[model samples]
Target: MYYSREVAHQIEKLRKGFPVISVIGPRQSGKTTFLQHYFKHYSYFNLENPQTRDLIEQDPQQFITLNPKNIIIDEVQRLPDLLSYIQVHVDKQQEMGSIVISGSQNLLISEKISQSLAGRAAYQNIFPFSLSELQMHGLALPGHLDQMLKGFYPAVYTREIEPNEFYNQYIVTYVDRDARLIKNIQNLSQFQKFMRLLAGRVGQIVNISSLANDTGVAPNTAEDWISILEASYIVYRLHPYYKNIGKRLIKSPKVYFYDTGLLCALLNVVEPQELATHFLIGGIFENFIISEFKKELSARGLPVPLYFYRDQQGREIDLIFESKTKLIPVEIKSSSTFNRTFFDAFTYWRKNIQAEISGYVIYSGLDSQKVGEDNLLAWNKLDTLIDHL
Candidate 1:
């Protein structure tokens, strides 16, 4: 079952103007499936296949000559040099959507694309299913805990794989294969430990030295591992929104997993009900909300202008969505019961900024209403907030 993707429209729009369209995202995020299904008429080729890779390496010109236009290349980063050839052909042919390429290893693909394809290629980031996407298919869960545990990974839906079982294999495959491919790590077990510790600190500021001590690795190694994770789209770092507010602000960034199901797997939370009393439930909930917002922006091919607000005085906001003209402050809470006290942070933030702002408090409660200048939104109605942004 193909749950129609929101990014498909953006990619099609890009195909109309660019010669090469680059689809970049994490492994198993459905890049291959989505491209194959959407561009079915295009000649498909997977460089992962040894036979195809050897033939391309044996005679690059012949490969380009044979499949001159309307080509979809999977895992094109496996042969970065081929992008140069594709660029040459497209430049001379002066054709739109002449070649489409997708890759999971973003660091490699991005570097190669910048060097070879450059302006000729347009990019679409494919993350796991968004809440809106799931809602369209009626696969979205009503409760926050159930949704967090189930996650938004396509395999969890398409293959009907249990969340725990799927993420367990996901971590192993990521550490054993993708992690190594991104950078050489001598100790895979230690890297796995680092990931677990990182997962435990989701939605909190990252301390590389502390993480290194916990994992028994150097701080540099810990930083490098984080980069590898970010490049592979396993995790995302949300930086602090800085302004001269006459108070000291925390500079370090907070890290969150792209998928809550993977976060649950690392934290060893098997059942959705178990999260009811779990110690990390609040952080997990926060991570889920932030990731959903990210997926929403990525689906529309918009820049993620998300940041967290925290200072030395302990004043903080869960998320700060910055646009060119105004900044939107958002606070995330896991409590099902609504409370006016959730607006305390918003009150402090508004006083510091000169701009008049309408704030939002996103909680697990079902009731969504306007409270004075602020909006009390249910977690499921996040799309409403996104739409206004």
Candidate 2:
């Protein structure tokens, strides 16, 4: 139904100030769709087309001259050389909203843009649909407890496609194409294996050596591959937050897939029913909700310094939001029911930190309630919390 995205306003703001705006995300995250919907009058070109690529490669200056102003260049990474010409044109013209570029491979596109159009461009990452956007279109699920389990991919939500077939094709076509072709990885088989292993280890602390062991590759190779995945928006590595606390917090980062649907696809999770019984259901659910929260924060142009609280003494909080000199701790439970034990970690965190501590238990329940002085919020209410922030 074409629900409006939070990035629309950001893009509009950037258009008023910058000559170029680059929208980067993984393939099929709706980058093209978004730009087409927003910039209807802008001339469009997909560099993936051989004729278009050849025209740009043959003479970038002429290509720029043909479409002088307000052009939308789709898959710009396919012709990285054209960015240099674009930079020169934007610098000479000094016209705001002159160009918009979209691509899936951030490693190539971002690096070229940095070198060519460093201060001349604004960048944004376009993730899949958010809960608020879905709600705006009146597509809110009646019982959204299963939302985190199945995740919110655009095609999955809009079409009546079988989850298994949809996800299977997504892995085979988009993920595989981007990982091997766009990233230029030599070991396709090993890369696929690495992805599947990472899916199983979602929401866990990053351990490259352990991943290397599991993937039967060198530690350095595993680390480099993870970077490629992160650069391409296939995965995200959330660093731990520690300022002056003397006690040793986790120095390592946690890994999460940008889209939980892709993660479930890698794990062969077909539907919500299958996800509920899966062994990694809890971890997957945690990853889903946390990633969506991060997306919400980014949509509002806020820094997401999200982390988990874990001590050597066996106490842990699943997600921690450190803002305005306070610690907001959250625990995510895949269970539809709540228990008193969920507050134990919150109690420990409150006792230790001098900062004001508030706790929330985000569960797969229909109704939101208070559990012994702590707030218990439903998964659907996540957008409300973000708005209140």
The TM-score leader among the candidates is 1
Q: What tens-digit string does per-residue lDDT give for candidate 2 at 30-92?
A: 788889999999999999899988978998999899889989999998889899999999999
State model 2's lDDT.
Answer: 0.80
**Whole-model lDDT values for every prediction:** 0.89, 0.80
Please give the lDDT score at residue 363 for candidate 1. Answer: 93
Shift in Å, residue 63, candidate 1 = 0.6
Candidate 2: misplaced stretches above 4 Å?
143-150, 244-250, 370-373
**After TM-score superposition, what is the CA distance of residue 65 in candidate 2 from its true location, in Å?**
2.0
Model 1 steric clash total: 0
Q: Output the lDDT of residue 311, model 1.
A: 75
| Clash count, one per candidate | 0, 0
Find the candidate with the highest lDDT and give its number.
1
All candidates: TM-score: 0.97, 0.92
* C-alpha RMSD of each candidate structure in angstroms: 2.0, 2.4
For candidate 1, the 10 contiguous residues with the lowest summed lDDT are: 242-251
